[model samples]
Target: MDHKAAKRRKLTDKSLPNVILQNPDFAEDSQMYQSLLEMERKLDWTITRKRMEIQDTLSRNPSTTRTLRIFVSHTVSGQSWQAGTESDNLTHSETGENIPAWQLKIEGRLLELPQRGKDKGPPRKFSTFIKRMMVEFDRDTNVYPENNIVEWPRATGHHNPPLDGFTVRRTGDVPTHIRIVMYLDHYPEQYRLNPDLSSVLGIKEESLLGVVQALWNYIKIQGLQDKADRRLVRSDERLRAIFGVETIPFQKLPEYVKRLLSPPDPILLHYSFDPSLPVVEPERPTAWDVEIKMEDAALKNRMGVMLHTNKETSVALAKMDEEIALLAQSLHNSHLKRTFLQSFADDPAKFIQTWLESQSRDLESVLGAGASEGLTLRQEELRRSEFFRLPWVEEAVSVQEGLRLASKGM
Candidate 1:
C-alpha cells in the first residue's frame, strides 16, 4: 500500500519476467549498464555460494562413495596442494600431504565420477488418502485457511516421521536441480516440466517424489516454514565447519583508479560527479568549446573600437559567439548532471526510471493522439518515478556491521 514498499516489491520480484521481456531496451543507458553489471554480480554470488556448497560436500567423500567427485585440475594443483602443506593435520588422506590454500595433485588421466540416478522418493498417494487418516483440521476453530481445491489429493504414505523432525528440502538437493529465478522468487520453467515430469520420466502414479516439481511448486505457493534466521541456524549450526565472509581490508588507490572500483550498485554510478579528488577528474576533451556573449551595448562598442577593422570585429564576433555557445552548453550539461544525481543518486536507478517513464510517455503519446495533456502527465509522472522514490543507502560498513548485515539480509 505504501509507495516505498510497493516500489521495493516491484523492483525485487523475479516473477516480473514479462515486464523485463517487454522492455527489450530496458537498460541501454550508462546507468542501466551498471545496474546490469551489479545484478550479474549478485547472481554470480548465488552461483558462487552454490559451487562452494557442492565443493564442500564433494570434499567430504574423498573417493566418492556418495556423490561423484569431478576435480578441476587447476583448483587442485595450485591452491589445494599449497593449502594441504600448511596444516600438517589437515593433510590429504591418499597423498598425506599438508593442504595449502588450494593445492592439488596430478594424475595420469582425469577421473570422472559418475552421477548416481536420483534416489526415487518412495511414491505416496494424494490428499484423498489423507481424508481417510481422519485428520480433522476444522478451520472454524482456528485462523488457518481452508483448502479450496476440491480435487486436492492427500499425500498418501507420507508416514516417514516428520512428526518429531522437520522436513528440510534444500534448493541444492532438489532432484531436478532448479535454478533460482531472478526477480520472481520462483523456479525456472525447466524444472516445471509440462504435464508433470512424471509422465515423461515414465514414473507411474504421478506421485511427486525425489525432488518432484509438484513439491517445489507447493513449497513456493505455501512459502517456506522457516524465517531467514531459522534457515541459517538450522543449516549451519556449527560455525566452525567452514570459514566464510572473506574480509579484504580497504586499501585506497590513487583517487583516479577508484573508477575501476565503481559502486557495487549500478545506480550509484549515475549520480557521482567527477571523483571528488582533483587528480581523478577526467582529461578535458578537445571538443569542448568556450564562448562568451556581451549583452551590453557599451561592451560591444568597446570590442568594436579595440578591433579597429570590420574584418577583425567580425572575427572577434565569431570567436565570441563560439565561446558563448560552449559556455552555455557546459552549463546545461552541469544542470543535467545535477538533475540525474538528484533523481536517483546513481545511474542505474535513474536509467531504469527513465526507461519506464519513456515507455509510459510513448503509450501516452499514442493514446492521446494530438492532445498535449498526456505528455504533461507523463512528465509529471516521471518526476515522481522510482528514481525519486527509493533512496540509495551505502552498504559498506565496519567488519562486525558488515557481517551482521550479511546475516540479516543486508
Candidate 2:
C-alpha cells in the first residue's frame, strides 16, 4: 500500500497545472489525460507556425492573396466638366475611343520584381510606393446610366481582369493580434476639418481637401499666383488662416496643409486568422498555382491573337503596295508621253505650219503690181537710210568733195 501510494504521488507530481490531476476520476487515467494535453499544445504551436508562414507568403504576393481596393473618383455634372465642353472633347487616337472627362482614381502599389542581387519580391514600404492610377469610370463603379457604354482603354481588350475583393474594416488605430494579421492597405487620414479653415476655403463642412490635389485646385481657381513670381503664391485672407502667413511657395503647400487640417483617425483592417476557426486549406488549388496556369493560357491566347492580327495586317499592306505600284506605273507612262509631245512643241516646222494655216486665205487676195511697187520703194528707202550711217558711203562722199575742189583749182 505504501509503494502504490508513492507511485500515485509521483504520477500526480508529473502532471501539469495540478488542475487535471486533482480530479478523483482523473487519477486512474492521468497519464492519458497528460498525453492529450501535450498533443493539444503541440498542435496549437504547429498551427501558429503555419499561420505565420501563410502571412509572410501573403505580404510577398499580395496579388495572389489580398484583394486590393479600387478607389472610385466621380465627376458629377455640376461638380466637374459638363458634357460637350472643350474638356469633355478628349479622345484616344490609338483606340478611337472617347476619354472620360471624369475619371476614377484607382490607387495601388506597383509590385516591381526586385532587381538581381536584391530583395526578390514586392516592396515593403506601402505608403511611399502607393500610386493613384486613373481607370475607366465603368470599371469600379456603376454610377453612370446603364445605357452609357464606356469603351475599354487601348491594349486592355485581352488582358484586363476584374479587381479582387477582400474583407475590409476601417478603424481608428492598428488593432492587436498583429501576429496573424497583415495590412494590405494604408488609407489617408479622414476626419472633420477646422471650422476656420473650412469657412475660408469656401468648401462645405463635410469636404476634406486638406492634404493635396483638391486644396491645390482651389488655390489655382482663386488666381492666387504671386505678382513678383508665379512660383510664389500670395494667399488672401481665407488662405492666410491655413498658411498662417501672407504667402507660401507652391512646394511648401503640403507642409501647410498638414499643419492646417487635422489628420483623420487611422483606418485599420483586421486580416488576422481566427484561432477558433479550423485551419482548412482549400480543396481548390493554391492562388499561385492557379495564377501560373491562367498566365500560361493567357500567353498562348495572346500569341495566337497577335499572329492572326499580323497576318491580316500583312495582307492589307500587300494590297496597298499593289495599288501604289499601279499608280506609279501610270504616272511614269504619262510623264514619258508629255516629254515626247513637248520636244516638238517649239520645232520650226510646227511654227511654219501654224502660221500658214492662219494666213492661207489672205495670201491669195494680194495685188501683184502694187506689191512689187511697195517692195521697190521699201528697198530704195532702206539704201537711202544706209548712206548716212555707213563708213564706206561717208568716205565716198568725202572723195567726191576733194575732186570738186581739184577741178576748181585746175
Tell me each candidate's TM-score.
Answer: 0.16, 0.27
Tell me the tens digit of each residue's lDDT in model 2 across 227-267: 77988888887777656798888888777765656533322
Please identify model 1 stretches exceeding 4 Å from their true place: 1-309, 346-355, 367-410
Query: At residue 16, what lDDT does model 2 achieve?
Result: 24
Quality of model 2 by C-alpha lDDT: 0.42
Distance from true position, residue 166, model 2, in Å?
11
Across 1-410, the per-residue lDDT of candidate 1 in tens digits comes to 22322433344342223333443443342365448547756765665565565456444322211211111121222223223334444646476344322211111111222552333333221111111111122222233245311221233365732121111111110011111111101111112222333333333222112224443343345443235432221112211122121221112111211222221111000001111123333243111111111122333344444324467656774565455446545644654565565554334434555867677767887876644777765677667667544544232223335555567894
Best by TM-score: 2
Worst 10 residues of 2 by lDDT: 285-294
Point out the worst 10-residue segment of candidate 1 by lDDT: 263-272
As for model 2, its CA RMSD to the true structure in angstroms is 44.5
